[model samples]
Structure formats: structure tokens, C-alpha cells
Target chain A: MQFKYDLEGGNFSRAGHASSEVKKILKQLNVDARIIKRIVVALYEGEVNVVAHAHKGVVMVDIDEKRIYIRIEDEGPGIPDINLAMQEGFSTASASVREMGFGAGMGLPNIKKNTDQLNIESEVGKGTVLEMTTMISS
Target chain B: MKISEIVDVLNARVVCGSDKLNTEVRYAFASDLMSDVLTLDTENLMLVTGLANLQVIRTAEMADIFCVVFVRDKKATPEMKKIAEENNIVILESPYSMFRAVSVLHDCGLQPVY
Candidate 1:
């Protein structure tokens, strides 16, 4: 099955809606709780990153019997340094985003931690695309 | 600890999901940073935070947390309550500060997860 959602940038309130919907779908599909949790965490962190940093974006979730795939594409001013941005304690979110209880710099690290495979492609002046996959244990 | 006991200990009001007061919680975690909460392995714990937003409920759901206690009398919006109710997550509002709320729960035998 495939699911997609539009992510509005700078809207902290709606950040995790996509992830939440995906979690609900995973639950209904009887996916293992552990795998569901992993997917939720990774997708949620990515969703927050898109909202906090991007201009606007879309989240696409593809689920199969063997694995779940997530792709977040944003048309924002992309990251300048993927390595530095992947560090656990690095973030560029504004004070307002911080006040909403995000931007702790753990977004990318958490995303990386929960997924079996991860890839990030971006251009400094154009946009970013984050792809992550978590395998389902038989 | 039962959610009812947590409410009594922290003097917290049920903001939503009152039917879940009988739910049991094994550990507790207190943090305002949603990212830290996500990274922490807090299964079946009650989250205590002063932050009031829809994302708080989302964090609790992602972590499989059963309950959330908003410390310092933080008010949750109707939308937050709606989301918590949908997730079957018990929501409580405590007038006590985060420190005092944690201390009260600790005194009542609710241990924190390090």
C-alpha cells in the first residue's frame, strides 16, 4: 500500500500528522509493534525536520510484506552540510520552533537510528529528499 | 502505578481519556524536549511535561506511553484533547511544577527511568 501527505512548512502544530496516520495504518495491518514503533519514530523525526526547515514538502509511505519505505521531499533551501546536520546536537531551528519543544538536533540521528536503510540527497539552493526503510521481521 | 494514583499524587486533573485512568504505567519520564522523549526507550511510561501541544500526544503515542501529565498547570487545547482521546492516552493537568510533580510521584513509589 502507498500513502502520501502534504507537509506545510513552519507549521509545528501539524508536523506529526502524517506519521500518526502511518502508525495507525501499520497497526491495522498487524505489523509488529516494535517495527511500527521504529517506523513511527523515524517518520516523525523526518516530518518535524521538514516542517522546521523546509519551504513545504510531501511524505510518501510505501508498505509491503517485507519492508516499509518512507520518502520526504521538500522544496526548501536545502541543507548546506549533511554531515554536520546529521550530528545529534546540531540544529538551526528558530527560537519559536524550540519553544514548541523541537529542534534539539536529534532529528536526523533519530531517523538514522530507527531505520534499516537511510539516504539523504539535497542541493544547497534547491531542495532535499530523505528516504528511509525499515524491514519487517517474518 | 495506576493512572488514578498518579492523578492523586500529582493533584492532576483529567483533561481527556478519563476512561483510561485504570491503565497501568511502569515507569516515568519527564522532559520538555520531544526529540529526547523520542530517543529515550520509554515503553509504558507516563510522560510528564510542561509543554502543551498536539505533538505531545503524538510523542506519547509514538513511544507507546499510556499517560501524559502536563505539569505547572499547562492548559491543553481542545485539539490536543481530541487527539489524546483518539489515541486512548490519558491526559492529566497538574498545578504542581515539574520538579514537585516528579517528587510527588517518586514519593508515591513511581520510579524514573534513567
Candidate 2:
């Protein structure tokens, strides 16, 4: 199965809408609870990252027999340095984003920790694309 | 611990999911950072946070944490409460600071998830 959801850049209110929907679908499909948690965490962080940094983004989800795949593509000021951005405590979040308890520089690291396979593609001043995959079966 | 017990111990108000006060939670993780909360892997975990926002409920929903205790009397907005109710996650607003709430829960034998 496949699904897509759009997200506005600065809309914190709607940040996790897509993640919540995907979680419901996974549960209805009887995905393992542990695996579902992993998928949702990664996806939620991805969704938050887009809301925090990008102008706008789209989330795509694909579920197969063995694994679940997700892609988040956003139009925004892309990460200039992927290595530095992956560090645990680095952030360029605005004060408003920080007030909501995000932009702690932990989102990508959390995403990497929860997902089995991850890839990030970005171009400075242009956009970013994040792809993640997690095994659905134990 | 039962969710009701947490409500009593922290002198918290149930912002939503009143019917789930009897829900049992064995572990608790406290943090304001949603990223840290997202990295958690466990069963029956309750998140203790200072920020009462939409993402807090969203984080709990994504992490499969059915209970969240908002420390320092932070209020959850109506929208947050509504979404939390739909997700079957209890929202507790406590007057205690994060440190005090965690200590109280710890003294009551709530196991830490570290």
C-alpha cells in the first residue's frame, strides 16, 4: 500500500497528522507493535523536521510484505552540511520552534536510531529529501 | 503505576481520557525534547514533559505511550486535549516541576527507562 500527505512549512499544529494516519494504517494491517512504534517515531521526527525547517513538504509511505518505506521531500533552505547537522546537539531552530520542545538537534539522530536504512539528500538554498526504511517483520 | 495513582500523587488534573485513569504504566521517561522521547523503546511508558503542546500528544501517540504528565502546571490547549482524547492517551496537568514529579514517581517505585 502507498499513501501521501502534504505539510505546510510553519504549521506546528498539523505537524504529525501524516504520522498519525500512517500509524493507524499500520495498526489496522496488524504490523508488529514494536515495528510500528519504530516507524512512527522516525516518521514523526521527519515530519517535525520539515515543519521546523522547510517551506513545505510531502510525505510518501509504501508498505510491502517485509518493510515499510517513507520519503519526505521539502522545498526549503537545505542543510548546508549533513555531517554537522547529524550531530546530537546542533540546531538552527527559531525561538518559536524551540519553545515547543523541538529543534534540539536530535530529530535526525532519533530518526537514524529508529529506522533501519536512511538517506538524506539536500542542496543548499534549494530543498531536501529524506528517505527511510524499516523492516516490518521480526 | 495506575494513571489514577499518578494523578493523585502529582495532584494533577486529567486534561483528557478520563476513562483511562485505570490504565497501568510500568515505566516513565521525562524530557522536554520530543527527539529524545521518540528514541525510546519500551512498553507501557508514560512521558513526563514540561511543554503542553500538540507535539507532546503527537509524540506520545507515535511512541505508543498512552500517558503523558505535563509538569509545572502547563496547560494543554483544547485542540491538544481533543486529539489526545481521540488517541486514547491520558493528559495530566501537574503543578509539580519536572524534577519534583519524577522524584515523586520514583519514590513510588516507578522504574526509570534509562
Clashing pairs in 1: none
How many clashing residue pairs appear in each of the predictions shown? Answer: 0, 0
Regions of model 1 farther than 4 Å from truth? none
Off by over 4 Å in 2: none
**Please, what are the lDDT tens digits per residue for candidate 1 over residues A1-138?**
999999999988898899899999999989888888989989988988888888899999898899898999999989999999999899998898888788999999999999999999999878999999889756
Model 1 chain A: ten consecutive residues of lowest lDDT: A129-138
Q: What is the two-chain DockQ of model 2?
A: 0.84
Per-residue lDDT of B1 in model 1? 82
Q: Taking the candidates in order, what DockQ does each have? A: 0.82, 0.84
Model 1: share of native contacts present?
A: 0.76
The iRMS of model 1 comes to 0.9
Taking all chains together, each candidate's TM-score versus the true structure is 0.97, 0.95
